[model samples]
Target: MIQRIQTIFLFLVVVCMGITIGTELWEQAVNGQSWKLSAFAVENLSADGEVVSSSSKWYIGALAAFVGLLALISIFQYKSRGRQMMLNMINSLLMVGLVASVFLTTNGLNSELGMEVAGSYKVGFWVILAAMVCNMLANRFIRKDEALVRSVDRIR
Candidate 1:
């Protein structure tokens, strides 16, 4: 059961979240200066590639890590398809929240600096989307497995 297709999907979600944790989610270049946003913080870099300043964003990282943990836990719940599906659903909501938090933070950063244009999203942001897709796929397969089990029980 643990070797099912859903397991691979859930594993991909975990991997994506791990990548999100280490990479920048968004970035912007303004007036020859650049800012990079990661799960833990945002760093303002000067033209010469020096850290001009940094601001904390620990909550984003925490949420991403939580989603990853949920996926990992879901992987081991192979015996309970219903519970695994529930965990997948919960992970979906958390992923949405993570995206919202990143978007709001990026907007806040821009407004605080009086910038009219928005920054370009980076790998970390996209990775969340990929993880969300994988979560959905995992849920679908779990549902199919549950249905199959029910059908088999009826046949017996």
Candidate 2:
């Protein structure tokens, strides 16, 4: 069961979330300096002279980690395709929330710093998008499996 296609897709989902931890989804430029916001940290790339580091919002990182771990755990629940589907749905919601929170945070940061934020989406954002798609596909496959099992039982 661990060798199931949905398991592989779930693992890919986890990898995408893990990679998101290190990549930025948006970039903002304030006074000619660019600041890229990632899931775990924000880096302020100074254009003129000095460099400063920005700390991360712990909850965002925690949510992302939770989603990834959820997917990983979902892979093991082969006995319960329904449960796996539920987990995938939950993961999907978590990812949507993560994206929304990121945008909200960027808006707050922009106003605080008097700058405009732009979609300088790095590798991380795209990965998140991929995870979203994978989650949907996993759910589809889980439902398919469940239906197949039901039909087999009916035949028996």
Candidate 3:
């Protein structure tokens, strides 16, 4: 029952991340605008001062990949308990990566452009943080269950 709930929650988190990334991409392609103000300048940077490559698409792709990976893990978790624990650990790490990316990207944008792009990034940051917390809670519950089973076996 608990595992089912955790799977549902993780699915929701993956969907939310996908939506957020999709929104950012739409903003970039349709509006010709940076998804977040901080992304604007970074997207414009040229490694050699002659070839400008935007990081926006790469970042969005990364998010999409992470979401896809999480969805796959969630689906497979039911088949193997060990895989479930591994997936939980991997998801937690992905959440950490998401948080770090949000902070660094936001800070990079803010320091270079002065808070103009903070709102979008802030929203993404908070959403990812909430997802991270949920993942952590789910992992703890699974660990507790494992411990309980071990204790019961020892008692017998």
Q: Compare the candidates by TM-score and give the number of the best one.
A: 1
lDDT of each: 0.96, 0.83, 0.56
- Residue pairs that clash (backbone atoms under 3 angstroms), model 3: 37-117
Which residue window of length 10 is worst by lDDT in model 2? 113-122
Residue-level lDDT of model 2, residues 1-156, one tens digit each, is 788789878999999999988666777676778887777776787887455777767777888899999999999998989888888999999999988888787777777777644535667777888999998988888898999999999999
- The regions of model 3 sitting more than 4 angstroms off are 1-3, 24-57, 114-122
Candidate 3 minimal-lDDT segment of 10 residues: 24-33
| Poorly placed runs, candidate 2 (over 4 Å) | 48-50, 116-119
Colliding pairs, model 1: none
lDDT for 150 in candidate 3 is 84
* Residue 48 lDDT in candidate 3: 39
Better by TM-score, candidate 2 or 1: 1
TM-score of each: 0.98, 0.89, 0.64
| Clash count, predicted structure 3 | 1
> Which RMSD values do the candidates have, in order?
0.7, 1.9, 6.7
